[model samples]
Target: MSWDLSFMFDDLLPALLVGLQYTVLSTVLGYLIALLLGLLIAVVRRVRVVGPVAHGIMEFIRTTPLLIQLVFVFTLVPPTVTPLTVGVVVLGVHYAAYTAEVYRSGIEGVAKGQWEAARALSLPLRRTWGAIVLPQAIRKVIPALGNYLIAMFKDTPLLFAIGVTEMLMMAQRVGQPAGRVMEAYTLVGIMFLLVSIPSAILIRRLERRYAAV
Candidate 1:
């Protein structure tokens, strides 16, 4: 059967955009949560008093599949909390495990001499991290973090399993009446590529920019 490209663009696109808005919102909010929490996890994991416990927790999160975590939250949380909110939190906390590793690597990559120099100057621990180490470490991990952001965007579709009307769910909704599954699915694929490709290119550029520093 011939594809009706016009129907896909004119009818399907708008419906998908509604879902896309939620997808974008989840990605942004979730990535913000992941970025901050991951850094905190990495930092806390370095502390002598709590390092082992933090390490164990991080490993548990890292080992578990994110889909399971999302389902668990959706099942166990109070119904008062919306599925979208639960999705955002699960996505963020799930990705935080991976980002934590990125952060740990970046923090470790900082030259030992820099830490020594900070100590030599009698810098307070907070000042040393804030003024010296973290600035460099965060810069080094920006590209990796961007990659996770894109990954999180793709993962937003999985919210469908939890009854969220994200892009793919909307695509299915759009297709059902028309019996144009191909058109609907194809459009969804194109939309994902449109955003993810440029994002990946930008991340590569960031990688180069930071590497030069």
Candidate 2:
């Protein structure tokens, strides 16, 4: 049978938009959690006492599949917690391991002179990182972080595995009753392309901008 382009746009789009809302919400909130947690992991790993343990944990997280982590969290967490919340936390913590590596590279990329200069001034450790190291490191890593956000956006469909009713899940629900799976899934692919392509272009621009620094 021929594709129903009209139904794809008129009926399917709206429903998918609702799902997109959840997708966007999860990505944004989850990315924030990842950014912060990754920074924390990177910073903590610099410490003399707990560094090895933190390194081991980060390695473990990075080595595992995010799908496994998501399923594990969904099964292990109390039902009182919403599936969305579980999805967000799992996505965040999983990506945080990678982001931690991003952060570690960024932090390490800072010139040794900067750290020595901080010491030369007798600057407090907090001030050294807060004022000097992090600013430079974060600026350098913006492109990488944006790329991860885009990756997370595409990965939102995995939320379906946990019954989160995200975009792909919404598409399936809308299509199943009407037996319009082609229209539904086609639109979903279009939607993803629409968002991801522009985002990828923006990230490239960011990479150029940051690389110039």
lDDT tens digits, residue span 10-110, model 2? 88899999999999999999999999999999999999998899899889988888888889889998989899999999999988998999999999999
Model 2 ranges with Cα > 4 A deviation: none
TM-score of each: 0.96, 0.97
Worst 10 residues of 1 by lDDT: 57-66
Pairs that clash in candidate 2: none
Provide the RMSD of all predictions against the true structure, rounded to 1 decimal: 1.1, 1.0
Each model's backbone clash number: 0, 0
Best prediction by TM-score: 2
In candidate 1, which residue ranges exceed 4 Å CA deviation? none
